[model samples]
Target: MSASPKYSVELIDGPSRVQFTSASSILRPDGYHPAGAPHLISSATAEVYGNPKATKTIRIGNGGLGPTGALRQLCLAFLGERPDLRIDWVVNHSRHTQVALQAGSIDVALTYEREEEQAAETEGWSRTMGILCHDHFIIAGPRQDPAGLRGLHGSVGRANDVEVSKVKPLSTVAFANIARSQSTFHSRGDGSATMHRELGIWDSAGVPPREQGWYKVIAGTPLAALQRAAADVAYLLIDRATFLYAHHIGAVRDVEVFVEGGSELMNTTCILVRTEERRGAVLEFVEWLQGTEAQAIIERFGKNWELGVPLVTPVSQLEVAPHGKRS
Candidate 1:
């Protein structure tokens, strides 16, 4: 499952180095079972691959989360539990989940962008099969939260408690305040889903980071950016899981989640399947993901994630309703 080599970011998996024009890059690891390899599909696996003793492949993809070891942990656990299905898991740009699914480069995609999920289903090429988790963001900053962003909740989950018409989400307001205060702020600047969402927040705040001396873009993954922000005592919006992972690993010691949760801060992940293939089988796997076993794995998996912190909320356990609006 290779894409055209016009990428803006480098896809590094072990020894392979591939680039593409799309912000999303594909990481096809070396020595993995080749696509279309013959394997004996089992009963449970047949629900996804179909038929025993047949050659079939299912390509699963996510945004650049593979480097975090979160997606890899989930994929390995799924394969370990099933043992009957062969998967060539993929990592691409999160912002391009819909494009990859539409291009048929990946059979299924775990996407954080709710708009993309709705668009693909509306276009009739894809269907959202399950809600994996609602991973929200954290306004990572110094201990004091000099920007005064603490306790600022977005419109999500606050309608019943606050004035529904007057509240603006923190995703927008926080960034604007960060800019107005001229406090330091770091950005990944990479094409990953995190970067896209950060940009969207800034845009919603009506203050793009363009030419701002205070806004700095660190070159690396989300973990790397957050670490750099810690060193600089700058504020940056980061995914909660990644921040917790960094904390658990002891890599980022200074920054913490000052503010989080809201419709705008919700990075709700959905398991999407291309409807053109064995949709029923993929749907079966999706069902398992939302099941207890997979949900447990999700709750437990994460390299830098701190245990008992609930970095990522399983769909079954989230306070917000599945397939429901956050704000």
Candidate 2:
């Protein structure tokens, strides 16, 4: 830690509820911290009146829910004390940071999007370089199904592919292809980067726009839209972190994650490093992440493995995508 602390940079995809608790445990007193994501958009106008040159490092922890978790709070505190400094922050998804890092664009990334490229760092790409966190997916739906999710539930349609509804131990929403319902399926709106990933899954499944009938695009955070789903019993997709918090607060509960304990299921976060400067301060940060302290924070923070959702392989394994990008 530099005593001068003169630079400010945004950290993307962090500061979850658990991360906040863990952050409070280790952050040094008198340090500056700032928390702001689109969820905490109010923080954006907090004012940066301090000397830009005086700050050594302005760290931004990326997390979508709100000014959540400890890392972001600490960063806000640091910035509050000294607003003047060179600051660069990118509070987006992990994939964004991963691309930036590999492309040599960012200094560091606190992300959940697993980078397949990092497979080179390990043998056979089996061991990905990342600090794992708890994450999972859930499907939301209407209590009654006009699209036939209820009828299709646990009922297999394909034979050679030998698909069975499987009637998952936990029930979320029925998985339907794009060809099935255009107006039936729902997700975040067009600008939402995450929606791109959802769209890709449909693409991978060979679900086409023509296949969809009742699909609708709603603009809002996962939790917000999830709430809407609950009210209307409309179907929606959600990440585990958001699901946990939402479920905890009773923001939404009827929906559940149908997929669990399979080769395809995974939930984890990672620290991304720009390929260009994989040395010095940047490397130190990456190494620090892998170290006991950083890993401890991530391990103990927002994501909960005890909930029984294991952090498995990289996102590359899933139809997970960025900007509707395909693998």
Candidate 3:
């Protein structure tokens, strides 16, 4: 009898039509025939080539535990936009999202801020999709109330004597105290844009280091910073989502949300599709992300009380609740 043909399809781009054969024994049981080429895509090139027409495999680059990763998962499940889509996820610090997307290593990416997209354009790449979710930067520290930020704020009955004493210059006092007390201050790495933003406030307020010993720097992701704070019982700046998730993982324990209510404290996240060709696909996925179905999944997927839905706030007007204030 003649052999039944099991035809294989090979996908390639550009004029290099060279073909090579793979060893028969190496074929995957799942039928994934390994290609005999580099078979790697840079994020920048992917942006130019566009996303695959019909969902096949999507290379998704994610930064970290914050909203970026959460948003991607929501797009996958509730949106049902790419049901069969296989996502190759690369998780790392938040800053890598743009680099991976631009390198063509990923087809789509979730990130924060618009500046990353601008950089993509300078390199001849287009960011086809966007979403603005309200995120907040918060202060997490040991539950012991060390610097007595909690004590300073005080309770309703006693009132925050320290806070009340510095009413006219509350922001200044807060920054100065954190700057002066090493025990009260720590941050996640020097390159972190968010950390830089906070430092800027200290500069503007003329809050000099209370003493060289009063400040410390912890280098890592939100989760790492959270862990450092938990271990040393020190204060560190972190995003709300990470703080919540870190607590659930037990990476950090006995922590509390001590700070809120500031212009610099408000944070936001966004999505960026690598190329113009895949704009439709990216938008479809983004819409699904914001859809009620996806939001529900997001609500459940995050760590116990640690994960939160992206902020659905208009950029023009943003506000956060005060420490003792309730909305």
Candidate 4:
């Protein structure tokens, strides 16, 4: 008869998580222990503490705003102190960002669509941290001004002189004229936050661009749409930052700012945290972004460079309502 064999097996649980692999050894007929055959481990258990410092990457989705570049620069500067930290930026339109956030593909999103933000909050998928900055949308077109928006600008200037409400009425009239004249208007058409704003303006004006030959939908980024507009000598509704960036980069020379400085044209970028798992880092980043140091960086963004003008106004200087509440 073979001699009985004795062996020991143990599992230790420590404060930190640990994984274990199983190995089986056979006792030889001569009472000699043989090396275990190499086999795959069937199962293992690991404990995770969910430490923020242990996180490898902080995923961020940007909605293609000009200020996003400054935000990325600030993030890199902040990460320099913590060599262990990293950032993964997913630059997309605001609508796509919302989808990614809801799908848990990204941890946070920076977007300019207030309605989408409110919907996410209502759906309990995310919450807005705060307003990062405010930028105004401007109508740009060929220097010839085919739509004759100068008259509208003059009217707005006169209204400002008298402290009367100018943005809504003038904007309505401008859209009416665009529709009336059938002037070519290039739309982002990419379901971006900017596109959402454009739709709102059209809706308020009671003139939908649907089936309108003069309204062209360019399904691309804001910059791409702007380039197409410039090439076609068409009018385009673009954010101030993107227009200035294009000018700075010499991407478009023919398009000029036709109409600006309206409350309805206000573009508010809001920060949102997708989940609670990375809430610690996200909250810290948000607090830092809203602080004086970060605000100062935002205030100086795109200034003294080739643009010669700041792309976005900091939240501090702009009076903005919190997300879900618009003034």
Candidate 5:
């Protein structure tokens, strides 16, 4: 425990959702190891795409991830909080977090969303789930709106004041409004998790931007794309954490969060371990991540970022995570 909670994190259930992970594996086609190949296990002081390492440590598959060092900071904080447990985190973006942990080449892994469902779907792998934290989506665009994107939905994107008052998911409506007005919208088109969610919201709104002239797919990392969106004065879906990083760097001063809050905008990351592996260290870290101590670290994380808003919201339980819980 930090013993002095600077910022309070909304307490949620620990590491619950298991969305598709948003990182990449660094192994080559035939066999290429970062540290001259492996001897045993499945990772190292690095992440394991599939290469076997030589340590039995709990290999959390997140590091130096996101724009503002959120996950990497979390890893550092965890180590600070619990010195007894040593974690070798490799920044992983491939689907192998599940495969390595499932195949017993590793102990546990932390990855993005719906992991519980996907874990269940995978025939023979046994895994237990916990809610780690949430990095939510913020619909951002130019401060000057072309589609009345902000005023039409108000602060939180609820369609209460318009003729389309019947309402759809406000997030969906936000995108639909962009299309209805043919407002320029940027798509990563790289099929990243953020991109996947953006497209899903469009589908949910029944207005896919398949061939619309207003829809333009942009290329680059999330930060680069965000900078592009700001330059073009276009609208795009961006993760709050990355947005915080971009904001810190002054990459998106012209953009503002138009639609946020509500579960539809949530992007969850979960901590997973084979229930059978049952490593005391893994279990301790997972439980502690959701406990008061680690949550305090997550709570005060953004104070370091120098941003007024916590990049990621604590929602599942401040008891699933409530960034909306300002203490």
Candidate 6:
């Protein structure tokens, strides 16, 4: 039948061009292809090319458990405002994100790991653009409050005794009590921002090295670690956003916010941009995040009927420097 009159078809859509032949099919360079189709021989690969003046793609590395979602929303809004730009988000915890930013794999990073930020600045690999938002860390535990941390909530603001004033904050004192009582305590131990804060609290409390039986370290995300804490009735240090989100979604029911509020528990999320060719766009995005419109979105995030409270406060509401330093 003379190969049924062999025909060639070329389809050009957006930034990709696909060619199909009667004898064979080829994969497209856009990384997409029709499913449930047999692979064919006679390879004639498709070619994909962007227009000479097409929009640029900005890659962002994010390392926060709760703020990641809100940042993605802000990115969508920015993209809408600037059609000439697109975004590719690399979501990982603070450690991995910091590594990626240092390795030149990402253009900008939204991170909460203070050590990583300091190290990057010292190494001259990245510089802080501004503070994105802030959320307080809260100690969550079973409603029964085995460590009696609920009572310490009142002491969050006052230091009645000189020894208490010299000691760590009330939240850290709660951790100290938990350690002394041999009550179960869950630690993320995954180099996340939350873990960083938790470690500081433990250090300030002068708690000994984590014991294996009572102190459990889960090398996982905050949400997963919180779930483990709930299952085991252990105490946990978590950002307000993650706790509230989990509570709203029914991921956390037995746990209650035991201790919160204080300068020690203030968590600031910062924007760090790599020193690279796309510095201008990265800086623009960072500046936009602190603007009125972006701040509005951040202030309202996680404030739906299910949660009834916002995850983070806008940076404008606080006295944070443009470079994310305390003013």
Tens-place lDDT per residue, model 4, 94-140, is: 75566556656567678887766887677576789888887878787
Model 3 worst lDDT run, 10 consecutive residues: 24-33
- What TM-score, computed on C-alpha atoms, does each candidate reach? 0.69, 0.54, 0.64, 0.74, 0.68, 0.74
Q: Which one is best on lDDT?
A: 6
What digit string (tens of lDDT, one per residue) describes model 2 on residues 225-275? 778767765666666556555655556655644333332334455554433
How do these models rank on TM-score, best leading? Answer: 4, 6, 1, 5, 3, 2
- Backbone clashes in model 6, listed as residue pairs: none
For each candidate, the alpha-carbon lDDT, in order, equals 0.62, 0.42, 0.50, 0.64, 0.60, 0.65
Ranking by lDDT: 6, 4, 1, 5, 3, 2
**RMSD in angstroms between candidate 1 and the native structure over all alpha carbons:** 10.3
Report the alpha-carbon TM-score of model 3 versus the true structure. 0.64
Model 4 misplaced regions, further than 4 Å:
1-55, 66-68, 154-167, 319-327
**Count of backbone clashes, every candidate in sequence:** 7, 51, 15, 0, 32, 0
